[model samples]
Target: MSHTKLIRMTVDRTVEAEPGVGPDIEAWRRSVAGVLAKSRRVSPDELGERPEDLLAIRTEDGVTIRPLYTSADDVPEQPLPGQFPFTRGGDPLRDVNRGWSVMARFGVNERDPEAVNESILAALESGTSALWLAVGGDNLPVEAIDRALKGVLLDLAPLTLDAGDQAGAAANAVLALLDARAREGDGVTDRSRVSIGLGAAPLTTLFANNYSPLGDTAKLRSVDLPGAVRLAATAVNREETIRALMVDATVFHDAGSSDAQEIGAACAAGVEYVEAMLEAGLSIDHALGQIEFRFAATDDQFQSTAKFRAARQVWARVADVLGARDAGAAPQHAVTSSAMMTQRDPWVNMLRTTVAAFGAGVGGADTVTVLPFDAALPAGALGVADSFSQRIARNTQLLLIEESNLGRVLDPAGGSWYVEKLTSDLAHAAWAVLQSIDGAGGFSATVESGWLCGKIEEVRAHRETEISRRKIKLTGVNEFPDSAEKPLPVGPDGTVPDRLAAGRVFRYAEPFEKLRNRSDLHLADNGSRPTVFLAPLGPLAEHNIRTTFIANLLGSGGIEAVNPGAVESSGLADAARQSGTRVAVICGTDKRYAQEAPDAVRALREAGMTSVMLAGPQSAYPDENTDVSPDAYLGAGIDAVAALAELLDTLGVR
Candidate 1:
């Protein structure tokens, strides 16, 4: 036998702080002011007129991120993990061993039960610790659940079902399968260790179906909210580890709700579920225990981390108010946001998902699911993640857990001034939203009165405006787009299949992708992409920056920018004619534009150019009636989507 070498390390906890021994808050504030003053003096332009405003960033959720946070900030006294209010995490020792569970999601198909089983077994044999099966409604048929899970050991793998309207039927199917497995004694150990999430989300379903409780009360009642609550009670009585309801906030998030809105909406939904369960005769603690939460983990690392933390605090507060203080902490499952996924340049999605997974793990999610990078691709069917994509998704979490050891430290983000302040701010904002929802008569009432949907629409409009103005840059879609990339396969009708047939889902990149699709169709018909001639007024050095900017902007909409090198003002017309494109954009420095852009614009117009565009702002010309006047101005902060669509129309791409 070989002796193992055990290395011992020491830690120091000797310096204990008394009440009087701490950092000087007033001195720190003075130092911060002095630093800001120095920065304004040294780099006035960088700081702008209001240096303070430059330091703070306001999120879409209306949460302000300060430039610097210190112990001087008004942060609440944070309790340890597993304590009441459980802001840090639900479980104190959650990070000690395996950390968060790596969950693999599969789209079930009744037509191919054997294939689905093979995929399931492959995921289990790999690094996936849990399974989230999309069942019913174009997914696995309720009756086919047993066949779909043929080889899977029920007691070993934790299962979550996303059955849409068929949640009760799917739950019964799973329960039947579990009963069969128990009777067979198929390596079944403790039933208490077997976790099953029934996924009965009536509010989310109603929202997805766009059913107005006021106008469509029959449809609302048809959702069988009471049935879902009763099922949860039944599941709780059957097994301790079975969570019968899920407050899935991604439904609101995908519709463009902000972080606080998503959290508040989720909490409101949780309260609704708890109330329904109580009406169904389940105790408060049992009702709370039977509910799990699902949130969308975005690429915003700090915000995503703070969101999960704040969500816990908000839910704990709600439960405490409901007299279930001890059962406040519930399991949270984090899935990377599909809204952030890009159809163009899909490889970049891997980076996005990686960051999302990291944030979720650090934020203390009980289970993390990384959707495949190509999840946004038109895979011709719903829930269709190829084996290669599945492997990458599975390994993404494994590498984070096994190699990076991201979860070894408990509350890794705890004690940091920035995280603490952000968490506190988010908690307060989300709780306010929940209170508003309650005042509006809870989740169903808000949905019926259109108050909740109206709020979501307002945020969606803001997000779209920001995206169009390039304030919210989507890397592969609206920023550095790959126009030459080949298109992914679509359905037979040439349209991308809708993942959610009934619900509305918004992808940040959809507008740009639409333009790209039009460009692709044009390329297929004309043997070349819709081309825009770049008419540079000065030398390469002077025009390169603006030319590069214009080219990137054009490429984002799949338009080809044809640069015929540096040309004189006289040659602008010839260049436009030679390029054989009616649209011509003059690119040069502001100084150069003032010198030669008038003649250049006149030349392109006289050459029969339908649209003459300037790369710089309209103020560069100062006089709109002069020969320098372009049909449109293409510059920073211009609506890129509208500009590109106009250019495509002018070029006759459609």
Candidate 2:
């Protein structure tokens, strides 16, 4: 062949003219058209006038996220990680080398220092070397302090204290503990091996909370007591390693912040703590080295991971403000919330724990505590549940670090569009909140004004609603029903006894003596019914609204819906006609009414659809004369699964 002919042939073989959007898009377009055709042919209700036009992406704080974010997404200029304003991250290795901490938390009472030591050792053995000791101010017994110190690697110091008044008894108790640690040693090597768990000063507490700076009794609880403990963590073997004592995320998670809020709040709190300590005669370096952090982990992986990253960013920024931007970067610890635990189906807790653990690991939490499944119940009855929970937590990290090698990628989400966007959004939102707190005077003022509580309660309400609607599934409680479950055992205290309290001996007391056997306490369990019917009003292929609606609903209820293929009005009728449907749900865009809704409804009604329903907008009202009026509407007021659940309730299924 001629040279030109050969060149043409080669070009043709190597690259053809651009294919018109590929067969997949064509197929999808055809499928969507088919769905619309069916809807127009069979359903009238589906063609309702109101249509879902705009997609609003708003945060819980009412902050709207743009569809696209660019470098311009940041305001006041986006600084590089480890640089000033540290939004990306404070350390040079933000997402590349340095990672978060995996610290363990221990309640210190020290009745049996040996047992406490054992617990500490157990945590360390599990690969978490850092610790947080919960102490009761002056009320903390010497035994608990001794116990807290017993088994911990000398490098692991804890933030030890309870929420209580800081003066008098609490102050005295904290002082005693600190005095003990101080007496243990003083020189470099001795102090190097020691750690402090001091109370926040009354002023520090007030300032941190945005209070009126009053010396009031209740407001004085979080103050710094005399003789605080200090120790170094092996985060990176240097200030650059991003490993040191951290502030617990639980404080904020428990305080009611969203994942973003938690990140910002923890960072702000850390900054406040460090600043307070510095003014009190401690060096910026010591303050950074001494302070640590924690956060609550949940099933939302991206959100959780972003939370950890945001935390580091905020801490880095704060340190920069104080001219100690290069100081030791403490780790962030994570714990699954007891507040989210449920008694309905304890087994589901394992799944929740697993997802949360995964997020913690990916998010770079130095230490994570997976609340046992039976944690919602008395510990003894936890039985196999705790084993699974522990397994999930441990194996999750192991798999990530060893198998997946996720640990090899520090700041794994540094460059991802979603993560970076989320990080920026969270940092900005949290910074705004922090500024508001500052404007109110500080942490003390916010606490006094009940502003802090208000912030938390908002998230709490959302969580409760999600839990109730099964939007965020809790296996036994919201999804699977355990008919055989027994009534949870009540402790002498009136509420359900802590599962942790039953089987294990108190560190302050006996030598591994078993506590009360409360396994007899179980929630009432009924046999499970796995059957579920998915009701979609429009044609399977054509009625293109909420395609994932049924699937999402079923998944949340622990039941997977089976679609009967892409059908239109006739197909829908046929489905309701042949399937043993316990419930029927109608799904379509409101605009479907203008097309094929009337016929679809008639077919469904004709097919003996007893449980006919519409998945309409919560705020929309049905026209008084609409022939496709459903027996019930699922959405808004009642989510899809919730509607099914109501039907189930009628059938005595739950």
- Over 4 Å off, model 1: 1-50, 74-77, 187-189, 211-223, 380-385, 488-495, 498-503, 624-627
CA lDDT scores, all candidates in order: 0.82, 0.52
lDDT of 2 by residue, 1-654 (tens): 899999999999777766663345435444544565475584423533311112235666555544444454444434555554443443456333224444455553344556666766776676654555555643334445555555344434333334334323433444464455556753334433443333333333443343221112233344242323222222223212222333544555544467666665566566666665666666777678667665778776777777666776676667767788776355555787655556545666667776777776666665566666666565556555544555455555555556666656645556766677776677677777777777766665566677765776677667656555555554444444443344445454323545432221111101000111121121123333333345454455544445465544444443434556556555677677676655555666776644554565566677776555556663333464375655665565464444544654543433
TM-score of each: 0.89, 0.60
Error of 2 at 139 (Å): 11
* Candidate number of the best lDDT: 1
Q: Please give, for residues 362-463, the per-residue lDDT of candidate 1 as tens digits.
A: 998989999888777655333444777779888999999989998787778988889888888899999999999999999988987888988888898889
Q: Cα lDDT for residue 215, model 2?
A: 19
RMSD score of candidate 1 (Å) = 5.6
Q: Any residue pairs clashing in model 1, and if so which? A: none
Model 1, CA-based lDDT = 0.82
Candidate achieving the largest TM-score: 1
